[model samples]
Target: MEFASRYLLRPSRICFPLLLLLAAAAAAAAAVAVPPVAQQEQDRIGRLPGQPHVDFAQYAGYVTVNASAGRALFYWLVEAPASAQPAPLVLWLNGGPGCSSVAYGASEELGPFRIHSDGMTLYLNPHAWNRVANVLFLDSPAGVGFSYTNTSSDLITSGDHRTAVDAYNFLVNWFERFPQYKQREFYIAGESYAGHYVPQLSQLVYEKNIGIQNPAINFKGFLVGNAVTDDYHDYVGTFEYWWTHGLISDSTYRILRIHCDNEVSEHPSGACMQALETADAEMGNIDPYSIYTLPCNDTGSLRRNLRGHYPWMSRAYDPCTERYSKMYYNHPEVQKALHANTTGIPYLWDTCSDTVGNNWGDAPKSMLPIYQELISAGLKIWVFSGDTDSVVPLTATRYSIDALKLKTVKNWYPWYDHGKVGGWSQIYGGLTLVTVTGAGHEVPLHRPRQALILFRHFLKNKPMPES
Candidate 1:
């Protein structure tokens, strides 16, 4: 029996500072102290230059995933061709902890193109991932977008485990909507804090497969873009990477070294926050990871900073003065499609809020233990990194996987396309790590070609591209 067409969809927590004073201070320090990793990489590979031109074409429609609790999720399917038999199914989740997948995935990342300033137009991206396989972009966990829940309790703190459960449940129910793809090889992929979501969900689904005695999950593997997995090394690596990149002044580095990095435990303290604040203040609007030096703050600099930091990902030409979000939440189509309760709520949707009850506090101390459980349960895992992301640097990913100590079936090798180096892939027991050359936090936005290549290999079980 087929399910209704409404079968749907799918962070991390990010707190924006009320004042940019610290951030401004951080920016100046970042400029003077650090060498931009993002710019250096961009220099190495180069970009489209000038304004990137995107051509937009409407593809497929949305699916509503109905939950027992009465909430629903809206999902967009980037379909593969009819000839793409038993095609790989990819469920793409974007991390805000509260950001919309449609905003990033469809617009900035790999869906197809950029949505124009008018909101009615689009430009096609030459590097969309769907060229290789079917892609599903989901806004998840009730209250994120169109996804909603019946119970207020449902809106409580979100973490790795709860998110995993909801996502796994979404998969089970989503199959009811698109039954045709039940047998298709399925993969869960995303970026940023999705590093935590993908693996945790993969682990949950794999466990349920054993408990339910069903093969429906069809879970071939899990893929993450610059994902945040292990808490310990990732947090520590942030400072080390900052110092190495010159974002942290030597004195500040020494300060962080003695106080911040060393003090990491199960739960962090004000000292850690202070250290991060120091780093954040130093980096300011200019991305510590990228080579792009931002103009100093003017009166309207906060909005400028927002746009500059997320140039490829944000739609706003001027985020501060225009207030794209205020206008966005007010759009009739957006309002009609979204389930956010704006009644007295400051934001139609809270991009970052402590009050929303999604208490996904921090990354776990050790993610390697989760790996043991997944492998023991017969799951395939893939960890991919965008080498230029300072937030969740590639080195952190390496350290996380290295802790797994998996037997190396394949050594590190560069992946090539059109005789150009695209990325590198390393295959170990039940897992793979692919690092894209010119990607930042969001691979689709920065390195769509490489992202597509990685997705194709994941879904089709195709061999890694030759260098």
Candidate 2:
């Protein structure tokens, strides 16, 4: 299976002798008043090996979630520019059941910088989400990214429930380390499989806040893009999308629909699997994440090395970015600079971990019940989609939302960005549905500016701009 395809099925551990070091670090941290600025500076990224100097502050480190199990989740925090006032805290996660948010979210998408073509350097992302909020990117479940565990069972047995619990534990401990933002308005954002992560985590946070007069974490809302919300709808929409886009033959589509419709579970039967295989063969080698975009060739060379003008050349998109990220992250110096790869993980850093993806358990067929609960609780909720994404396409998202039967507050309309129609949105009583025109599975990577605008509106609890 292709790397991205495995993520659709996406899916941690522990230790002990390190207590002395953690106690010493805690003692040292407690000894000082450590103003917010100074404490942030303490976690400051002095400089990435080849990154450009920037005015904003950045921090990367780990928070031990299960000390007994020696499971620690890594995080990267990019504070909003000092002049932007005290911005809200936004926890950003990338779905893969096992993908690294630090790799994809921080470097490839909405973080302050993007990995350069050389794989050793970085460039500013002018539309980084941190411009409006303190973006916190986490690598969760103890086996993704730099996060690891001493327990082998954590790696092979991780599922949705454990992941949400671990993530919540990470946030509580993270707040203790940086108490400055404990009471700040907070939000959760993520994409893809995070459709599960974001809502599940949000629900936990909400439950934790009950009866607490002054909760340290003031979670305001959440947003998800191109998320996997409902398995049945996702399956139907995906097949329909393939057939409509002419990526699958009519026979394959019919067979898939016959064998897979209403198959709520991610696991499919032998006949269904065969039909999907036929559909995949019909789709060929195109990048399923972004059907309209060119697939990255397996050649190790960077696309920037090509001097001639090519139709696929794009300043905003790089199909080979995952390759660059792998090279950059595996560099020993880079790992040291980020405070990652601590304890010397046996394996090299990867964009996604097959072990985690393959072992994922407890993924419910639908998140609709959770969405209904959150909506009833009056939390701000927004769902956005990248129209060009074949994997978890807009059709899937629309179908899932439609199942909610939300009262429409505003009929569908074109939302503008700099006077150009960026996408379409429909405001409902408790939710909003949005589509980013021409974007793919990773919306921010494909349409950074529009994604930023969408994010700003989401945080502000305002409707998408229409002109």
TM-score to native of every candidate shown: 0.73, 0.90
Per-prediction tally of clashes = 33, 11
- Highest TM-score: give the candidate number: 2
**lDDT, residue 155, model 2:** 72
Model 2 / residue 69 / CA error / Å? 0.9
Best by lDDT: 2
**Per-residue lDDT of 1-467 in model 2, one digit per residue for the tens?**
43123234331111212332343234334344555445455666788898898888889876778777767788898999999869999999987777889878998889888887788888889999989999999997777877777666677788899899999999887887888898999999999999999999999999999999889989888999999998888878888898999999999889888987854254567787788678778888777888776677732354455324334323658887887898898888888788665444334678877677767778888899999999999999999999888888999999999999999999999999778899999999999988999788999998899999999999898999988
lDDT of 1: 0.58
- Model 1 ranges with Cα > 4 A deviation: 1-69, 83-86, 211-214, 262-267, 288-330, 334-358, 361-363, 376-378
